[model samples]
Target: MDTTLVIRAKDVHMEFPVKNGPSVVALERINLEVPKGQLTALIGPDGAGKTTFMRLLCGLLDKTSGELDVLGLDVEAHSQEVQNLLSYMPQKFGLYEDLSVAENMNLYADLHGIPMGERPERFQKLLEMTGLSEFTSRLAGKLSGGMKQKLGLACTLVRSPDLLILDEPTVGVDPLSRRELWAILKHLVHDEHLSVFVSTAYMDEAAMCEKVYIMNHGRFLGQGTPAELSAIASGRCFEVKPLPGVAMRVLQSFLLADSRITDAVPSNGAVRFITTEPNLEIAWLVKQGMTPVPVEERLEDSFMILLKDDEQELAASSLVIFADSETETAVEIEESQVPKSDTDMPQLDYLHLTGQTIADDAPIDIEVENLVKQFGDFTAVANTSFQVRQGEVFGLLGPNGAGKTTTFRMLCGLLPSTSGVLNVAGVNLRHARTQARANIGYVAQKFSLYDTLTVYENLRFFGGAYGLYGDALERRIYEIMDEFGLTDKKDEDTSQLPGGYKQRLSMAAGLIHCPKILFLDEPTSGIDPLARRNFWQQITRLSAQGTTIIITTHFMDEAEYCDRFMIQDKGRLLILGSPADIREQVQLPKADMNEIFIEIVERARDKGAM
Candidate 1:
């Protein structure tokens, strides 16, 4: 037992048995050491056992075989003690929506058995640290996504545990708030001497940590400081100037398909890639008419290259075994057993989504003029106006509570606007909300599928809702399932599917009717890099096939996939343009989307705008 380390795992291996198939290996020969008073990051593609390992540390799941220690205590032998010595915040931190901020903190304090005398000082400090001091009276449900996360963090800190284990803490948060949370963690490490272990989808966040561990296929790929990991691709990275009129995503897709390239992604108005063979090949570049410019590798570049080299992706289903029966039977549950989600859903009937010849004149598909939505005395969205052209991918971006969702809902015709001229697919939204929705497909921020249903059943239900029945609907469902790579898992239980598959299922259902325009709200939020890449490829395909796409995403890299993007802050549209245009507007033409976004938002705040 090393007293200097907060967590130490040696020869850790976790496996779950399936009654009818081979046992699922969640972790294999895992070893780790987290020194006291340091921040450690756990990053991997989806179903690489990140959350599983974190759960083992928190004693939420018992490890199958291994020596696990937390604060010098054997976790398996003293599960309760280990839990009491640390705080574990899962991705979905439980916050009572009906409870006020102060009330939520109090509830957590009660759960952790914090002394009443120590509650006030701790609560006050946490509130101030999270920038939620003035919102103590606000109900948790009323808070923005960022504020809700802050409140969850505050609640977790009520007891001042020795270690903090956070799983994907900034998954769906906006850029600004994500930075804020990291700042808070750094402060805790330096000022309060707290040891932290966290998982995150953002590579930039992992780069900020003192140590990073990359995992794939339930095994470790590499572990080191950001600089050390980045060195893996030191001589293999290059930025290619895209051909004229070629979209960045299209260029990325092309580069990725080549056998010589390990990975290629959108980067600051260019396509960045790593070669399977070392160094730049000038002859190859010449043949393709590409000007190769060598560039330094970031932590993400190393991660993607490593994953590709590993040649494994748990893209379809999670490996975790859910015991129902010895024959691997599923519990009898209907689609109604799951809670309902808000997706206008994909429809193909009203307007053609099937291989239609896109007209040369790309007319506006969505036109929003003077859009305004008021909730009591508060303006959820101001007089906002924007247009999305036919077959284009447009992105809407903002911090939490900045009215991104309000605008999205308006466009989907799920909510009526207080004042605005909204039109979609040539239909006036204000006058024909239902009719407008018929021409659009929607996949919300969260996975909008019935977990209790099978993949095929969920699609069947949604297809029927959209007036697709009999062979036409059935054929469309199969076509979509195959298109999104869900055909093999058509009969699999939806709830048991991996996070990435759920994302695919959501996408497949939304396109069942092949709606002319698709609205995706944070579709790739919590999924891994591999899953995001696949999702974007589908989006790119759809855009090329002439389906207009309007999406909102916090991942700047994903935003780069857009043909044009609109930035909103405090219910006001701040900027709208292509990646190059926005970068130039922010005086950061060479910076990435993340840099440009922060600059634009910060300038807007500094100008004293709400």
Candidate 2:
């Protein structure tokens, strides 16, 4: 690799003072370099300081210590120049919701001082490239989640800068939108020689980058190509399929029990375990009389190993400098002993299946017959038909731009179907929009709650809108607040809560009126693993209470919670079945849901289903 660097940081550190005394280290001794014209990815879990680094590179934030340079210019000394040369897309890039699509683009162009002569050409090209030509008149706030993201990207690309920095650009985007975004990015890098630095949690996206920097705890753990990183865990991973209801928790317990196992993570009904020792055999599994099958090392498995190694290294460093002998002894003692509760303990009801049942002969909660939606010459949803049984968790699975959102809008009475019949809760959505909407609740892909309103206020407003009032509404709101652990934050503004809590509030608001059916569009996107588990618990509880849920998610493992699902591509339905049934239909020897989804989409495309 060439040593010429466009961006460099040496021993950078950033610390923010908390309320009390101690400080929170956002970045510590971070060292990274981005060669000109290469795509460099900063990959890690949430709160790993990827955003902090991006801010530093773009001269948006000052480092507490150390040196930083972009394009041979000091970040602190030449902030204006760096800002001129770098284009940044923050996690929440300011998008004017009130403006039309074209108006927003024009606003960006004027702010950037682009020449009038170049503006028209650039604007036209961008519109054509991003497929936003026809939607120019649409209000930014009215666009779909994926469309909004594309618009954001287009706005940032209006000017040709030396480097482009995107923080979690595809975080909550659907698979199709993700692919489209990547395609645009790849084209820019290849054709325009654009130097791209992006942060992502998706392992597949990381694999496609020219180089990757894996970070944890505000520090870089490793830097390499995807193949090089996976090589670190070669021949050390094993896949285990335990009995029903035991796969995930059992594997988690085993990883906690055995120090030899560097990592254990759940993936589509199985656990992938990685070990560092080359000669380490599966003695632990054999002792427990369980069988283990060797499996290929994926990028996620490699990331897990890297995280574990980093954790151990931190532990060892702490031990070496400990001043108290008791503390060191405690560390050693804890390392040698596994928690008693983890061994042979029964698994919690992770699914949280509540005991509520809808009438077996109840009318279908949602029915779509010959539904179609069109945009000029493009058909988004074409003659799609399905029925969702009452009390069932019906999943809408599809690649990006598969018309899922369009279909969802029609069902919710937010959009008029081009043709066909649609019914929700025994009411035709087209003609009886008010009655249909009253019986259904919807959670959009983005955070749709008021940012300035307190949690309690938001709940109160939503409850009131649903005809909830007086003491009854107050009582229900309090109950929900307690149930979701948001009672303490009831007075805090919705925007002030963390991402997880905000998600909980959104779910709570959707269920405040106890509608017969709920619609969730990618509800768990950008949520952490632990929070995702809790969110699923809530979903299970709702299902048990006889609420029909129609949800769409890109997280394949979540499909296991659905009663049945349909996978769509473009405007066509590809497959419809339960999670297990879909797996079986794929017919791959060891394929999981993610792999199965990939296979089905690819096959559908080959067969012209799109």
lDDT of 2 by residue, 1-610 (tens): 2237788889999997867669989899988878898888888655678888888888889999998999889999999999998889988877899999999998988889888899889988888888899999999997766788889988998898888999988876766667778888898899989999998767788889888999877999888888888878888888665444342433444443354666555556565677667546665455444466787776767776776566533233322111111111111112323323324322233212222223458568888899889988989988888888887888898876688888888888899888998989999988889988888888998978999999999999999998999999999999888667688888998875767778878988998998999999889887644345456656655665578999999877677567678998888788897666687788864566667777888898887844
In model 1, residue pairs whose N, Cα or C atoms come closer than 3 Å (at least 3 residues apart or on different chains), thus clashing, are: 347-513, 348-513
Number of the top-ranking candidate, with lDDT as the measure: 1
For each candidate in turn, the TM-score is 0.91, 0.73
Candidate 1 lDDT, 1-610, residue by residue in tens: 7899999999999999988999999999899888999999999988899999999998889888889999999998899999889998899999999999999999999998899999889988999999999999999999999899988899888987999999998889999899899999999999999999999999999999999999987889999999999999988999986655667776665555444677777887888889877785634444546688899889988998888778633322222111111111111112332112212211222113322333447798999999999999999899999888898889999988899999999899999999989989999988998888888899988888999999999999999988899999989998888666677888998998988888878888888988999999999898777667667777777887778999999898777888889999989999998887788877887887887888888999999655
Local accuracy by lDDT, each model: 0.83, 0.76
- Candidate 2: residue 422 lDDT (0-100): 94
User: Candidate 2: where is the Cα deviation over 4 Å?
Assistant: 1-3, 15-25, 92-160, 183-193, 215-237, 241-291, 302-364, 372-380, 413-439, 467-479, 513-516, 527-534, 537-547, 555-561, 569-572, 583-610
Tell me how many clashing residue pairs each candidate has: 2, 1
The number of the candidate with the highest TM-score is: 1
